[model samples]
Target: MMRVKHGSFNHVEVVEEMIFAINVGYKVNDLCTRCSTSQLSQSRRFPFLRPVRFLTDSRDVLWIMDTSEPQIDGPDPSPAVDHGLLAELESLRQSHQSLRSRSAEMEETLLLAQRQREDCVNEIANMSKIIESLCSERDRLASRVGELEELLKEKEDKFLSKFEEELIERESMRVEIEVYKKKFESVEEEMEERGGLLSRSMEAVQTVKDGLIKVIQNVDDDKIPETLGDENGGNGDLRLDSEFMPVFEQIMEVRKLVDLADSKVSEYKEMKGKEKRQLENSVVSLTEENRDISSLLRVALMEKEAVEKSLNKLKGNTEQKRVALLQFAERGLQRVGFGFMMGSGGSIEQPMVESYGASSTGSKSDGSECEEEVVSLASTVEKIMKNLRLEITQLRRCLDESRSDNERLESLTTKQAQQISENSLYIKELEERERLLAQNIEELLVDIKETETEVDRWREACELEVVAGKNEVEERDKVVTILQQELEKTKSALEISNGKLKLKADLAAAAMAAQATAEKSLQLADSRATGLRERIEELTRQLEEADSRERSGRRSIMRICWPWRAFIKVNAGNGAAPRFPNVRRMLPEMQSLLHSRV
Candidate 1:
């Protein structure tokens, strides 16, 4: 019996060896038949070949080799063999050698198959390792994407906060602009009041000047009458001159006061004009600043809108990428057969069980790890998608709020622009009015200068008239002394010559007529002196009143100036105009008084 081990030969090689051995047995059988017919003794010496049994190692299966003759116990046969038997033995030996070579070839083929199977297993292990690395890379990329999304959210939040802050600043600027407008309005009203006051004061000064001219005219008319009066009027003329000297001095003082007041008024007017120009410039600058601020706000809003659009586009791309990644993951799962495993349910479980029976526990553990990783990655992706959705919603809400704020800001800017335009127009109107007022002031100044020249001319004429009246008074005094001496000599002659009674009587009648005329002239001079004294007293009183009024006007102007100074300081600081409530109330009363005087 021949035994074949399991590792040494496979089933195909063992079968092939058995078949070859069977054929050799058949040849031997045929040779024995021929030998049996030719030589019976030889056939008896070498009996027909019996069946050969082959024992397999593990199965312990017995393969019996069949032969044409049975085995027989006999003595040694002859060494000499027939030619036919020798030829048959030689053919069987060649066939055996061929079978041995074919068996070696079969062993080589079996070894090649086993080696190919080992190579396929190694390739599968390498593919699984590559799949694991790819999954790990995908997971890392997903984490990086999540970090980028978080950074995007942070950046969006910061941008939103900055936009909100800008909106607040815009609102503050709008409020400040409104405040500036109110201040401008108040300042304009104050300027108007000041202009009215100046007009009223000018009117008052004109009326005072007219009254002074009338007083001067009255003094000139009274002086002409004093120069024409009788000898008794000389003493009265001297008394009038003494009284009128003080009135003339008072007139000079009043003229000085009027000039001072005029100068102060002109200075005040110049100051007001300068302040008005400054205010206009400030307003224009403020308007320009407001326009620039509005433009900047518009730019900021546009940038915010652009950022919102970019964020929306990024969100859309991220969503598309997420969906694509999810689809790719689904396809990967399908390619990895996980999708079939999930879809096939119990049918798939049976295959898995069979695979588990055939494959090692290590393969089952790898599949479980892959499934766990897929589930975890999917859950993480779902969570990330949810977070992205929430962030997108928040960004949309922020965009809506920003849009509303932008609309409000735009409205505010429009309103501010309108207000600025209106203010500019008002300023233009004020400028026109100021131009007209300046023209009027120039005319007034010219009239005042002309009146001053006239006053100086009149003063010189009055001084010359006073000097001529003084010389005429001295001549009248000398003539009155001569008349008194002649009258005494005539009375002595009447006393000595009693014979010329008729002549003495005629001289007495003439002297009496002259005496009556002299008394009438003396009475007229006394009345003229009383009238001149009353006129002088009235002129003095009027001058005093004018001086007092001028002082009051100066005081009021000083008060106005102080407030203006304060206003300038405040305006320089914050562009606010000053309020003069007291001055504004007082102006109307001054206007009324000036109107009454006029």
Candidate 2:
């Protein structure tokens, strides 16, 4: 038996082994496989999703337990279902509504996230601009800072260098002062010595004056009267009053001497006055030199004091600048200490060390540019130096070349001189030769004249001989006539003798020509033989060289063959050698051919 929990519940006991099937929120079929029971007809009931409420007898409301049938697991439906199925369906609808509400809330969240993303992107853009602006400011500040630093360093270096140079100059000036002081002291000593010399000369003049005064005082009145009478007295009176005359003359001479002494004293006084004037002039000159030196010293002292004051002022200024720079550096570093976003977060951050660093980088870039400019200047300077060096080298080379050319010209001049000398010598020789030739020519002319005279004489002799011959012929003719008169037969014998003489003269001329031809032929034969012998010698030398090469090659080949021959001989003893007798025999034939050619 089954008990129903709600009004919608239906239960039936089955005769067979019964099984209950519960499907919440689903209708049951008439035939349930698990339950052998009568089918509960649920189609007649209207489906409602209201909550099951039960009223107790006391009018108290009690909610009923939901007995909805389980949903079908597969395609099969449950056999029975109560109103619980409607309640389950209502609950599912409520859950779906709640899920929809959650989806809407998620969409709102997504929209808010997107808005925040846009704001963040905007903020990032602003920050980027701020950073860029800060970077620019930093670069500018750094550049300024770097420039200041460089200027400071340069000024300091200049000051130091100037100080060093001034110190060295001062040292040099001090040395010059010391030398001048020594010169001044030596001049002072010389002036003192000169003063002493002047004093001594004055004393010597005073002593000379004293001695002359004493000599004048010794003259007497008697001497003066005698000297006055001696002008009219003779030699005998002078001898009688010799003593008196001599004393008188001495007194007169003394008076003249006193006058001369007075003149000498005046002259000496004038000379001493002149000397005093010269000494005064020298003292004035010395005083001027001393005044000049004192003035120079005063000027030097003033300049030194001024320089010291200026140097102190400069030092103070430098110190002040240094302190100010240090304070600025410290203050700047402090103001730009590390921090997050500033009051103007999206705007720009205050520039600090980073700004200075950027500025320094910019300044460094400027410095690099300056360095490049300097480098270019240096390159130009180097080029100028190179040009100077090249010019120097060229000048030196030119000088050397000029020197060489000069030397060459000098050598050529010397050669020309030698050639001139040679030419002069040749001219002299030629002149001598000409003189000799002239002499020879003169001798030849004389010889020619003599020869001409001889020839004339010969001609005369020949003429005379002709005449004699003619006379002889005439005498012969006469004789013939006489003979003819005596004996006519002798005439034929004389004619025969004359014909023989003519034949002898013709034979002598032919013999002379034949001898000349013979000599010419002998000379031609000798020249031909000499030329042939030279050609033969040349051919022989070539042949010898060729033979030497051939012999050397043959020797090398023979040396190589010797080893092979020895091997062959040894192999032949072992009965392993090849024979070629004809090749060995051809060597002698080849030698014979070469010998025959030679």
Candidate 3:
């Protein structure tokens, strides 16, 4: 019975994957609460125990044997057994009964052990959780302390830097004060020189006043051109001296004013000296304040260094504790694995008689006692097995729930990781965009600087152009003045030329009148020459006719001297050498001669 329960526990432990043992052995009434009949299966070595039930009695043994026969098919052994085999079978029954009794006792003992082990495991689990919580708190506190220490260090560094800067500023101010003191001394020297010059000018004014008064008194009345001086010379001289004497008295008053201006200069110099001393005192006070601030900064830096060292020590300790906890968990898992393997071997079955005990008494009263004992033992074993099985099933259900929860948690983790990745990518993209924006801002600033530079350049160029334009305007004005002068000169020359042309036109009109008179006289001369030439030509013609008549009369005489000559002379050379023959022949000889001559 104990072995049966132990076997059930081994099966449960294998199935549940727990470090603790599982036992399903329990009574029928208790079984209903622990494991359902559906959760159990036959062991590999107990193949005859079908339907999740072990063959505990003779009746179950007989039932298993009969039911498994059809599966054996054709092979059969002899029904009668030999004496030796029978004796062996009887010995086996006795050994089986003894094993059953022992198993019952062992089962009770194991149940008590399991309860105590469960309590111990529970305590360990709780302690582990508390330790984890404590470790987390320690880490959180250490981190906070580190942050505080870092903050203190940063503050200290800043304080020291500020004090250094203040000291540098104080030194710079001291240098500036020294420079100002030198400038003040130079100004004081200049003031002293000016005061001395004023005093000398005042003395010179007094001398000039004295000289003017003497000149006014020594003026000569004789050099003065006075119209009424002749009436009373003494009276005129006395009046002039009276007016000049008052002018000498006014010069004496100016010498007194010079003394007052000298006194005021000395007062101003004293006031400047007092102000210089006050400025020197202020510079000294600022130097003292700078020294005090430097001392405070040094103290803060020392505290920061001490805290940093302590934080480093705490961090090293936490690391060692973490390594130790990891090693302990590893060893625990290895022990659990070894226990599971041993339990698996114990899960295989023995014989049925050994699994379920029988009654030893034959009397009715003894038989009842024996049956009750066996039945009670079997019932207890079954109850314990049922309980173990139930526990295993419940543990398996818990493991399944835990697995489902783990899967859900893994899924949630994957989703969260994905979301985180996306957020990281988004952040990266945003950072890139921010970088681009910063670049754009830088570019914009550069552009603005360039634009400002260009504007400045353009402004300078415009100023130059304006200056050039002004110069050009001045040049144009100069040229316009020169051109106006030339235009006036040209207008004067044009007027003179017009007067000359008018005079020339008047002279030409007079010459044209003279030429007309000469043309009339030349025409009269030409007419007289024509008449004289015609008279000479007429007289020459008359003389030539008279000579011709004389020659003709002589020729008539000569013709009478010859025979044919008288006929030729009568005809007078054939009237005119035969122009028309009939005219010459019909006319008388003298008539024809006279007609031809005419």
Candidate 4:
């Protein structure tokens, strides 16, 4: 765009590189004093004898110029047409060099796009592998949770069945107590009926004996034999009576019955006492069993509820993640800029591009009109390329952001993994506590069964009139009660364990939620990476398409150049073609560069 010197040196050598001044009208936008600010005008100073046509190069720069000029000796003479042949040639050479530089710049832009596309492809492959591994790990965790739930249910069923058995044993003891009460009442009735008869008989016998003793006293020593005989007479008569003999035998039988009844009463008392002790023992056992086991069950229930809530939360998170993935897949290009630059670039192909043929056919006038049109087209291409470059930069920034998101997702995954491991450790501790509690309960139940059997034997012995110490049963009951205390302690421990398990489950759920979030982020990153890869692929396709278009455009320009080349050969004494601006030779290096990047 530098101003051409008015009086530079003469004898400037022209070496066939000329006539590129048509599209250079862009340089004169501010060069002319009377040039309209609203629209572009062309340079009229360049030497041209008639309407001439020039071809565009492979850079998509518009060509097919009409380079005709007004006669040198016009009414309005211009300083531009008065230049020596050498000076005109020198300016043309400069214009030709500038065009070469512009083509090179466009080629460099295409190669860079290719490199970026390759990098995007590499990144996507790595991210996909990471996502796959994470998915597998999540499946393993879900399996572990299911196994834990099944184990808990089994334990609960076993405990409930043992409790029911204890209840059944208590119901049998009640039936034995009722039978003892009825037998005790019959014994009381027999004692009252026999006692009254025995009292009357003793009084009559005493009166007879007293009368005999008084008669003996009156007879003194001589009457001693008669007194003795009188006493024996009544005794013999009374003894011979059927009623007396029966009365004597009835007294003996009543005494025997009373002795048996007394023994039976004593045995009943012992049995009743034993029953009372056992009832109290059962009461204590039931209370302990209810207290410890029930509390543990409540804790377990709470834990189960927490786990269920967690599962529900996890389900919600996963559902949300699925929805997000679906949305990303549908709108990934818009959301992640996969088609952002492409859309803008597509718009750059406006209707103004259609005016090239019309302008080329226009009547020649110092060639300024065509130069101005070419200049306008040049400016438009530059603007579009700038915009495209900016979009490429934006896409690059998005790729960087997605990478950062991936790094953050990795960090979150590690944190979640750590939390999961901690939850596992906590779960293991809870399982061990639960196991210990179960063992204690089983042992206590065995002790209770033994005590029950011992009590039954003690009651049997007392009923058979074989005396047995009550202390032994009492001691056994003490042992049973002690075992119950241990059972209670174990139950409390189990409750604590359940509570801990609940906390751990909650923590695990939180971790799983976080893991789900990380999974989503990873999925998003993966989608973004995939989008970048797709965009890059599209960009490469566009680049290849542009390359094909460039080749066709080059061929068209060469078609226009063919006649110009012949014209050059007729003027040149050497009879050979010029070598500058030959992009056909550059194609091999361009292909090699693309291959290296690929």
- Regions of model 1 farther than 4 Å from truth: 1-8, 42-83, 185-598
Clashes of each: 2, 17, 19, 1
Ranking by TM-score: 1, 4, 3, 2
Q: For candidate 2, write residues 1-598 as lDDT tens digits.
A: 1222323311111100011111111112111111212222222232222222222222221324345654444234343443354565576556545544544554464456456546544644553454355345445534544554464456446545745675676578557656655655665554555443333123223333343443333221112111223323444533433223333343344345545654664564466457446545644553454355345435534543543454355345435544654564354223222121133233222222223344434334433443343344334334434554564476456445534543444454344344434434543443454345345534544554554354344433433333223223323343444555445455567778878988998899899889999999999999999999999999999999999999899888887544345544655777644443334555666546534543
Task: Name the top TM-score candidate.
Answer: 1
Provide the global lDDT of candidate 1 against the true structure: 0.51
For model 4, residues 1-598, the per-residue Cα lDDT tens digits are: 1222212311110100121333233222212212221121244443343233333443333333344566475444355534543465577567676645644543464456456546544544543454455445445544554564565556456556755675565556545545544544553454454344434344333333333333223222223233233323444445535434444444334334444554554565467457557545644654563455345445434543554454355445445544653453344224222353356434323322433333332322323554555454455445444654576577657656655654555554455555455555655655565556556555655766565465455344333221111122223344666787899999999999999999999999999999999999999999999999999999999999999999999889876644335444544745355433343544666545534543
Candidate scoring better on lDDT of 3 and 4: 4
Q: How close is candidate 4 to the true structure, as a TM-score?
A: 0.25
TM-score of each: 0.27, 0.20, 0.23, 0.25
Candidate-wise lDDT, in order: 0.51, 0.43, 0.44, 0.47
Could you tell me how far off, in angstroms, the CA of residue 548 lies in candidate 2 after the best superposition?
99
The sequence of per-residue lDDT tens digits that candidate 3 reaches over residues 1-598 is: 1222334343323222212111222122122211122222211222222221223442221111123523343333223423433565466556555545544544554465456446534643553454355345445534544554464456446545745675676578557656655655665554555443333133334343443333222221123222222322333333435333333334344434433433443354345345445434533543443344334334333433443343344344335434643453354334334354455534422222322343122223332433454354445445545675576576556545544544454454344445434544543454454455445545644654564455345434433333233333334444666787899999999999999999999899899989988998999999999989999999999999999999998988775443343454656867756433344444467555645564
What lDDT is reached at residue 388 by model 1?
A: 44
TM-score of 3: 0.23
Worst 10 residues of 3 by lDDT: 20-29
Instruction: Give the higher-lDDT candidate: 2 or 3.
Output: 3
